[model samples]
Structure formats: C-alpha cells, structure tokens
Target chain A: MPSEAQAAPDILSVELARIAQDIDSSFDLLLPVPDDPRRPLVEAMRYAAIGGGKRLRPLLLVATAEMHAVDRDTALRVACAIEAIHVYSLIHDDLPCMDDDDMRHGKPTVHRKFDEATAVLAGDALHAFAFEILSDPMTGGGDPFVRAELIYTLAMASGANGMAGGQMMDMMAESSRFDLPTVTRLQQLKTGALLGAAVEMGAILGRVVPEGRTHLRGFARDVGLAFQIADDLLDAEGDEVAAGKALRKDEAAGKETFLSLLGPQRARAQAEMLVEQAISHLASCGAEADILRALARYVVERDR
Target chain B: MPSEAQAAPDILSVELARIAQDIDSSFDLLLPVPDDPRRPLVEAMRYAAIGGGKRLRPLLLVATAEMHAVDRDTALRVACAIEAIHVYSLIHDDLPCMDDDDMRHGKPTVHRKFDEATAVLAGDALHAFAFEILSDPMTGGGDPFVRAELIYTLAMASGANGMAGGQMMDMMAESSRFDLPTVTRLQQLKTGALLGAAVEMGAILGRVVPEGRTHLRGFARDVGLAFQIADDLLDAEGDEVAAGKALRKDEAAGKETFLSLLGPQRARAQAEMLVEQAISHLASCGAEADILRALARYVVERDR
Candidate 1:
C-alpha cells in the first residue's frame, strides 16, 4: 500500500477529499431536515448520503473538468448532483428484493440501518434531490438549457439504459456464463455510463467545442473500461482489509468477471492498455491532462 | 353514466376525449424502443406506458391550463410528463418488494407481464423520460427558467416528500389501521401532490400572477382531496366490471381510506362538499373555469 505521502501524488486522495468537502457543504443546505412527520425518513436519507464512500463519480467530474481548465468550483454542483444520484442508486440496490446486501462501505446498508420503507423514501428523496439541485439555474450560474440537458443526461445515466439496465443484466446474468462482449456491454451500461456521463458533464460545462467533446468521450470510455477491470482484479486478488468489504464474494457467487474470462495477467495487461489509450486521448490538452493521466494510472494501481 | 347527450353544457365528452387523445399522442414519441440489447426491456416499458387508463393526471393538467387560457397543445408536453411520473410510481409500487399487486388497470402488472427485473427497469426508464420531456424547452417555447421551475415541481411532487413518501407510508401501513389524519396526509402526498402539480404547471405556463397562483393552488388542493375520496368510494361501492378491475381491494387489505374512516355515506358527503369548494375558487374565472368545473364533477362522478 502506498504511504499517505506517496498516495497523495500517486492517486486522488487529496483531490477526492477536497471534492467531498465541497459536496458536503452544498448538500448541507438543500437537505436540511424539517421537523415534519417525515423527519425520520429524511434523517435516514442524510445518513445514507453522508456515509463514507470513494466519491468516485464526483471526482471524475471534477478531474475531467480540471483537464479542460474549467473552474473547479463551477463543477461543484454537478459533482454533488452526480453523488446524489449514485447514493440514491446504492440505497435502492440494497433493498431486500434487489441485491439484498446488508452492508455497504463498512456500515449497515440504508434499509438495514433504517426500515426498508424509510430506505425507499431516502433513495427516492436523493433521486429527486439530484434533479432539484441540477435544475436550479441560480446556483451554478447555470443556463436553463444546459441545466436541463445536464438533468436529462444524469437521469438517463442513472435510469434504464445506464445503471438500472446494468443492474437488470447483472441480476439476470447471475449463475450464467457471459461472453466477453456481453460482459463488456453489461459493465459499460452498469458502471461506464455514469462515469462517461461524469466526463461528458465536465466537458459540457467547459464548453469544449464539438471536437473536444468527442475526445473527452473517447478518453472517458477507455478509462471507464480500465476502471471496471481493475475492480474485477481487486475483488479477485485483494483482501477485505484493503478493499474494505468481502473481496471474493463475486467469484463465490459465480458472477462473471474479467479475470474469470481473461485470466489475471491478461486482464491486468488489458487494463494497462486501456489506461494508455485513455491517456492518449488527452495528449492534445497538454499539462491539463496530467491529473486525468494520474487518475487512469491510479485506477489500475490502487489496492481498492 | 352520462352519455354524450346527457353531458352538461360545461362538460363536453368530445373535448375531454380530444384532450386525452392529444396527451396519448404526445407520449408516443417519448418512449420509442432503441435497437440496443435492452430493446425488450424498452418494449415492455412502452407497453406499460401505452396501456389505456383514465389519464386523470393529464386531464387535470389540460383542464386547469384551459382555465388559464393556455393553449391545450402548449400544455400537452407537461401533461404527458405528469402521466409518466404517475405511471412510473405505479410500476415500482407493483414490484414484488413493494405492494406486490399482480394486476394494474385490468392487465397483468409489469413484473408479471414482463419480468420483475424488466419491470424495475421500465419504471426507471419512464421516470427519467418524464424529466426529459419536461426539460426540453424547445417543446414548450418558454424561457428555460420557467421550464426549470416546472421540472423542479414535478420532481419534488413525484419524489420523497410527495408520491414516493406516500408510497413508502402505504407499504409500512399495510394491514395496519392509520387514523384519518395520517390517511389524509398520505393521500395528499401520494395523489394530491401530482394533481396539485398539474394545476400548478398550468398556472406557470399561463404566467399566473401571485394572487391568481394562490387561488389556483387552493382550487387544486380541494379538488385533489375530492379526487382521492372519490377513489376510496369507488373501491368501496363501484362495480368490478365498470371499474375495470377488482373493487374494494383497498378495503379488503384494510388500507386506510375516507370511507373506512368516515363510513361510506359520510365519505360521499365529504367528496361532494370538496367539489363545491373547488368550484367556488374558480368563481371569478367564468367561462375559462367551465372545463375545470366539469372535471371536478367528474372526480366525484366517475363510476369506476
């Protein structure tokens, strides 16, 4: 494991921290608990939202935006919006009828911590809150059209074709063998869509013209594949101490994985290839691409 | 039932049918099945969306907009949006983990018709489609800022404190006796919020001033309450064939209802009184209010 000092430069620990602080500050206002009958439900929502996680989605947005030299503060609202959407998905995914997982991020899942009923509301609230924040034109000096576009994209990313679709495929694919193409499509929708949306939102916010948008999309696509493969590797090879949860649960459950399909060494090599391609997409942007490159490397290199 | 000839001068069946037709036409373009592997899932989504119902939410929106002299065509997009939100809630509520109902609008529930996983995705797709349609400013021809407000209100109404909150409460209250006050609150959040939002959207589109907004809100609040009470009465007294599904299921489940709390006769009396109050709010709007008045009557008068 990288020491604290080494981790600082090698990965996004510092950047992720700054982004978390920024997100917490904004949600602090929008999610204030009212003393109404639904107060407990709202409190449970706050608890689920404030739970510690990697803040990967938000960091991707910020980091990608930084690559275009866009104002990091300006992207803060979108970052928070993305995080809210992610948290909402997690809450719903943990419901009894879905993944049925009892623990997440080292704490009881939302439904386990609160009643399943409250967890449902908490997830719904966060889902609504994401759009509510995104649609507020005043906060981000947001263009109404742009805000609307952002909301539309975010909703789609979190909805059927993105996270939800990925989830359905994942559920259906359980105990079944999936070819590499099928697995790629599944991971692309399940995990890559939102990550791609993060990069797209950043580029959109930067007002990067048509060509830049294409480049960013390409970069995000490669990095997203790399990111998921690394996850598969970590789950196969790492321990719970480093990964923070059960590591080999996916394999035990017989879920398809990159390593299972390609072998560990091959999967690791493929991930490196993806990272190189991702970095190549940003070469035109010069020094602005530094953090994105670091992020791509960090994706494969991190223990978690 | 009132035949076309028996309809009141203010309540033209042709006009209502036209409005419903237009709303259905608008939704047609919003849920097209893409050629992705998720196409089957999207087809199921389209099925859930296209099935016939009263289209109450859209009717309320169009009628209220008519009252404000807003063009019915201009109101079509928002009306479709409200229906999307309403339908999404229904799909999710019917999931195995939630209410677990097997039938909706006389057809098999989404999970039974498609699969549980597909149903979940169809619901998620429809939910996102609502916001997408609403946020597209080109359709509404208004300042995007105004459209943003409409999107915000819709999200909140369908979200945690509104429809989703009520759903969660309904789930928790299963087989339990909730007092009149609690039931009233649930009705407001679940049914009333969307109805109120319909009226509010019309007012926003028509650019109602502050005083007019207040009047319209009061009008919607009373009408929304009346609508739910009438729903309870229908479940209590309407014919199963006429209602298009099993009747008194809510009563059978011991779900809270106005009739349960106040008895059938009293509930009918309460619904009628609310209709009167609803009309009184539109007292000054004259001819513009006629369609709305007819709709209010329809709420209490719907046989099914």
Candidate 2:
C-alpha cells in the first residue's frame, strides 16, 4: 500500500466525487417532482439542488464525519442538509431582486428557467427542507438532543447574524465604502458561518466532545477565509466559462473585495497562507484528518 | 362569574389582546436594532414581526397552550416562533414579484418601505430565526426532544408540502381553473398547515399524548378552513381600508376562491358550519376549550 501521505490526495478526490454522487441521488429521492399542480416548485428545487456545483460544503461535512467514524448514512443526510442550504442561498442570491444573475453552474438560474415566483418559493422550500432533514429522527440521528443542536446551529449560521447579515453587508458595500476589517467581517459572517456550521455539524454527528472539536473549529475558520479569498481571486481573473457565472462584476459594480483591496498576487498568497494555517490546526488528528487537510488545499486551488 | 358560554367570548378577546401585547414586547426584546451596516435587514425584520397584525396565529398557539396548562414562558416562545414564520410569509408574499401589494396592515409593505433585496433577506432571516427560536433550549422548552419535535413539525408545515406548496397553487390558480376540492386542499396546505401546527405545538408543549391531541387536530383543521373562507369573504366584499390590503384582487385576477366556487351566501354559511363543527371537536375538553371555540366564531365575525 502507498504511504498515507502519498495516498491522501487520491482519497480526497475520490471521496469528494463519491459524496457528490451520493448527495445527488439522495436529493433525487428526497425531492421527487409531484404530479400535483405545485410540480413547478418541486422541479425548480430539484434543478437548483441536484446537477451542479463543486459540492465542497457537503464534502467537508462528510470528510469531518468520517474522521470521527460517524455512520455513512447519518453523515450523508447531514451533508445533504448543508448542501441544500447552500443551494438555496445560491438560488436566492441569483434572483433578479438580489444579484440579478441569469446563469448559475453553467445553466439558467432558477428564475431564468422557471420564473421568479417559482424561484422564490423553491428557495424558501429548500430552506425549510434543510431544517426538516436535520430535525427528522431518521435523518438527523437517533439522539434527539443532537438533532436539536444541529437545528440550532444551522439556524444561527443561516440567520440574521450570519449569512443573511453578510448578504446585507455586501449589498450595502455597493453604495458605501468598507474598510478591510469590515469586508473581512462580512465574508466571515456570510460564507464563513455556514462553512463553520458544516464542520461543527459533522463533529456533532460524530458525538465529538466540545473540547476535542476546538481544533476543527479553528481549521474551519481559516479555511472559510481562504475559500472567500479564492472566490474573489476567481472573480477577478478566472474565465467565466470555467467559473460558471459572471466574472469581474465586483469590479464593474465597484464592490470592495479582497481582490480589489489586496491585488491578485497578495490575495493569492494570503489564501495559501490561510490554507496552511488551516491544515496545521488539524495536525493533532494525525492521518484521520488527511481528507480535511486536502479539502483546505482544494478550497484555494479550485477554479470553480 | 358568568356561565361558561357567556364568559368565553369576553375571555378570548381579552386573552388574545393580552398575548398580542406580550408578543409585541417579546419581539422588541428579541430583535433589537443592530448598530452594524446590516441594521436595515434587522429593521425590516422588526418592522414585519413586531408592531402589527391581529397576532391571531400567536394567540391560537398561546390559547391552545393555555388550554393544556403549559408554562407561559414556553408558550410565549412558541407563539413568537410561529408568528415569525407568519410574518416572513407575509413579507415574501407582498413582494413585487408575488402579490405586488403596496400595503399590509395599513402600512407600506417591507419591499415598499425598504427595497426588494432587503425585504427578501429580511424575510429569509426571519424564517431562519423562527427555527432558531424553536430549537433553542432556553426558548423552545426544557426538553431537547420537544425542541426537535417543534423544529420537525414547523419545518413540515412551512416547506414544499405545506405553505410554499399552497402558495404555488394559489399562483397557479390565477392561470388554471381549480375545482372546489382543489381550492380547499390548497387553502388547507397553505394556511391550514401552520394554523394546525400552532395547536399541535401547544399540545406538544403540554406533553399531551398523540391520542389526546387528535381532537385538537380536528379542531384546528375545521377552524383553519373556516378562517380561509372568511378571508375569501372579506376579500370579496369587505372594505379595503378595514382589510388593510387590496380587496377583490381575486376577482380582478379571475382566480378561483371559496367565494367564487360556492357563492358569497353559501360560502358564509359553510364557514359558519365549519366553525360549529370545529367547536364540536373540542367538546371533550369542556370549559378548557372555550377560548378555542370563541376564536372559531371570531374568525367568521371579524370584519378584517
């Protein structure tokens, strides 16, 4: 057998692909299109949730759960829950009243494909479904306390002080100038909160003690920042076809981003440094954390 | 003291008024205006959640909880959670892309007062906050299992199969014709589900057995349908100023409604019949169910 160090990258890619397929099939079963009149909403939800994106959030969740030996079935459900939230956010963000983007993941956005009202309801339904999945006894875990904690954590991460708050800050940034600290805080709340929750949820599912989960929290924090920096970099210079969405819009809109503030080279270096710091936090976990380490690196290196 | 029948209506109106005031104050404490740039979102959330409406949903929740002798604090929290969901739905429903209404509760809609993006984020945040409230041990109840159950029940009531599904059906009704049964099913899912959840949550909080809760479910189902028919009646003939929203839009849009399907006189009679049936379901509970009975009659009697 190959050395653990040499085998880590292959395992990371293989595992990510495996979880992506797993989530796709799970969502298919979870959200079948109804024969009723409301099938449009269901179809929009399925289209937005299934069929696209890197599935990075779910991969992170499942990877962390694997480190703690959580059951695959339980891990997959939590993974799907997190992914559903992510997809819902993307759908809402793409709405004409929000980001006004017509394309997402190289296809027409939900509103573009199914109209605005359907898009709104689809996103709303997906948001509710995420909590449904987490709170359901079968999907969450055998322990009700764990399920309650998952619901609490996910709700906080997604609510006023977190993702929605960050989006508000981003919109405010369009008209108001924000310092680097303010922008950093915005990214931390908007994207970092949910990413952190994904890791925390996996730890919760594994029944990891609070003290033992501290390192994972630190890892998630660093990786979340690194992920945002990478996104800014991609928007600044990456190909639209490769990125699967509009690029350079931040520049066009004069929005303050890490790229605009730090320039490409410095921002790239900062993300790499953050990734290394993220990996270091997981060092005490030994080889069981290899996939998480790979994921931290993947966040910065991914093109889309 | 007056006999139970004579005292019920007075007690209900008084209790409802008390709970409405209590909820308004609690929301004030729960959602204070933030000092950050995202204050607008918080402001919008507070505006939608706090100072307005009949607080009927929360009253239903609190009154039902009162019937089971649940703690006031626990009942209040659940009341707030259900109200949060109700307010969020109203905010989203009034969006320019949806009902396109300018006024709600005799004031400018969230989108009209702020902006569409802010309105959307605010509504989304409120939805998240509802689950946050229900899953938090301090708020939901002392029991984690109860909190988990609350989350699951609320999610099921709010998601694709419930409110969102009903909203989709309502939108579809504008273009496609629906029979009476179809419209009734739509109303049941859209509005009935949440209303039913309010009573069920009260039962759950009281630790009432599922077998014991069946009567309450039937009560909620009948009252829910009656409530919607009254709404249709108000839309068809009530004063727009008193209704606090546009009136007769259903007719203008040629949408099918209980009033259109059954005619005004018959629809009014049906609502009253439903209320009678609703009260009959609670007969086993005796005087403890008086407030619920009063509320059922109030549904058809209210001008707005």
Among incorrect, acceptable, medium and high, the docking class of model 2 is high
Error of 1 at A225 (Å): 0.9
Candidate 2 second chain TM: 0.96
* DockQ value for model 2: 0.89
- Give each model a TM-score: 0.89, 0.97
| Tens-place lDDT digits, model 2, residues B1-304 | 6698685768767887898789999999989888999899999999898878988888888888888788888899888999999999999999988999999999999999999999999999999999989988786557888888888889999999999999999999999999999999999999999999999998888888889998899999999999999999999889989988888899999999999999999999999999999999988887878888899999999988
Q: What is candidate 1's CA lDDT for residue B259?
A: 83
lDDT of each: 0.78, 0.90
Which stretch of 10 consecutive residues in model 2 chain B shows the poorest summed lDDT? Answer: B1-10
Query: Which lDDT value does model 2 have at B302?
Result: 92
After superposition, the stretches of candidate 2 with alpha carbons farther than 4 Å from their true spots are A1-9, B1-9
Output the chain A TM-score of model 2: 0.96
